[model samples]
Target: MFTINNLLDIMVLVIFMNMQEKLTILADSAKYDASCSSSGSALKRHGDIGNTAYSGICHSFASDGRCISLLKILMTNCCIFDCKYCLNRKSNNIKRALFTPEEICEITINFYRRNYIEGLFLSSGIIKSPDYTMNLMIETISLLRHKYKFGGYIHAKAIPGASTYLLNKLGNLVDRLSANIELPTENGLKLLAPNKDTNKITKIMEYIKENKSQTFVPAGQSTQMIIGATKETDYEIMKRSSEMYHNYSLKRVFYSAYIPVNKDNLLPSLNLPPLKRENRLYQADWLMRFYHFKVNDLLNADNPNFNLLLDPKADWALRHLEEFPKEINTCSYNDLLKIPGIGVTSAKRIISSRKYFKISFNDLQKMGIVLKRAKYFIVCDGKYFVNNLCFNRSFIESNLVLEDNLLTSLKGEQLSLF
Candidate 1:
């Protein structure tokens, strides 16, 4: 039964099984990564095989939360670093796969034509060394751009230890570049992803901003920070966000709520990631960029985080209640923005409509501004229209929560729709 030919036959079967297993493992592992979308650079075909569109396509998501489009597979699943949260961590006892640059290009081209995906995502697990892996990633982009003339949307991951030259070159070809901050703080990185250098990662982000101006990467750069994995306060996160926006001119900083994939003793064992915290951070970020609220105004040493119950802006208003009860008819647009229920859109509507005639409480209701919270903060035509009995802003804010649901449901109704 143990003949030489029989042994060779078993070995051949084993190799085939291993290859099949590797593909399944790597693709399944990649499903959890949600860093999708193409919005940075625009590449023209110039009589080449393919072309890039400004609005890139994202197909769908599996249960694990990865956006499924563009053949979202890693170049290799064999990592050198032992990031505890990563599925492909060096200590992971799982099947691994590595694709040659040509193989990846062939797959992308075929997939694009069949309408399976618009392009390629092409991330890796730090095979061999960071510098070497970075080169391979660049080489893959080079092959796709130069040899294949692939003008489709290509989103490439900037390898951690990759040189500036490699990043700048890769930036030229790909539509978007993301250098994941992984963890929020240096201590978090030290505990969760020991090998990662926080300083080096930040430097790469700055370099991306510096170079992307004159050449490609018009969409600018975006990075991801894992939340709830470490003890980093939301204040700390926003502080870094402030610097990142000011110094590097980053387009977005995404937050991936940390779901413990591995059962490490050091990690939390929550059934779901801190989605609420993630939502609040996005809200705060919107305020910073659009609402003209500074990070310092939102948090301080004593209050180094956001309130889970109330939004950041509402909470800020509660602490400083004396500024409320302003005249709605005469209040300027900038002043209207500070009112609890009135947003930029509503404030502009008030300013435009009131110029024709003085605005009353009835008129504000017709303009579609939420009045429950605005009542405590605004006066209509020299009349105290609302109860105003409860001076506490929190009581008014609590009642305002129902408006979002009511408005959302009324969107398709005949009264609102047509």
Candidate 2:
């Protein structure tokens, strides 16, 4: 026989417990999404609470090189589908939590004022159905914008198999959106995450494309594929990524190292995450996106995987020795980009500065080119810089050197948020 006052007291306790308990559980649950980076949004919403710029979001890098300061968390950790590799899969015995739409709005506003976060990166487990989960997230973002006037950046992941209408609604509100192609191929999804497929995932992207002509997803869409999860080759993954850029107009493709979170017969027992492979893939992606390199330019049947010892660009240069020792004086801008160690800024500097004065080896170093790496690939005016170094064989060990002046490079300065 509980009194009305007793019932109220019990309800109050449950609510308090939910706030702290759920925040921890849901935040930890959302950590698996590496595509939550909030950048490249040129949106300016009038009278909004937060603002999104190229680097307006804080660029606080983690010790592991991950950026932070976004209030990234899941709406719920209770899923209907059981993906074996997932820590929060239905079969896994774990603490579950849910954040109401109002609570998400409250947290974002409070965190913004306290300077604890610059924006929100919201994701969720498939609770009840994809529609239910996506709508809940959409509701959360709507409250942040309309009710709280939160003008801050928002990057949300679209749930696979979610309704097209719900998907369209979501694109209108957030600064950026992503649909995680968790596994590299359809076969990998069928074996592990049996319920999900690329077909359903691509439908959302297709819808976005149809709607993109309007103001939908103004910051553009991006995606992530978990590397080392399946038997898919680097060539296959890169081919798919290139197709996405040309086919769906994707802004970026993120590669996540497969960190084993659960034990399964389907998964390999690894000592550590394949971070080196992951880094190489990102460098390859950069070549495609920024360096004007094509998929075929980086890979073929003979060289399916990128060399772990050297970067993708340097590796390509080493393989094609005949192309090296490029005379910088007469090379076109496009050809300059092909040289190893030369980036967009350095290539531009060569073109621009050469018009005024003849480019030299020392001048290149001042222009932010890594002389140690570039010297092996370029001939300055008529004289070769590293002419003595043999390129007939792999110079991987001797040629290996890091460019410390990345921040001073023309491209580097352009990327700085502040």
* Model 2: residue 35 alpha-carbon error in angstroms: 2.0
Residue-wise lDDT of candidate 1 within 124-183, one digit each (tens)? 888667788888888988998889888778777788888788887888877778788888
Q: Find the number of clashing residue pairs for candidate 2.
A: 3
- The true-versus-predicted C-alpha distance at residue 120 of model 2, in Å, is 0.9
Every candidate's lDDT: 0.75, 0.78
Clashing pairs in 1: 40-219
Evaluated with TM-score, which candidate comes out highest?
2
Model 1 regions lying over 4 Å from their true place: 1-24, 40-71, 114-118, 326-333, 341-344, 347-385, 388-391, 401-418
Predicted structure 2, TM vs. truth = 0.89
Model 1: lowest-lDDT 10 consecutive positions: 1-10
Q: Give the local distance difference test score of model 2.
A: 0.78
Candidate 2, residue 358: Cα displacement in angstroms equals 0.5
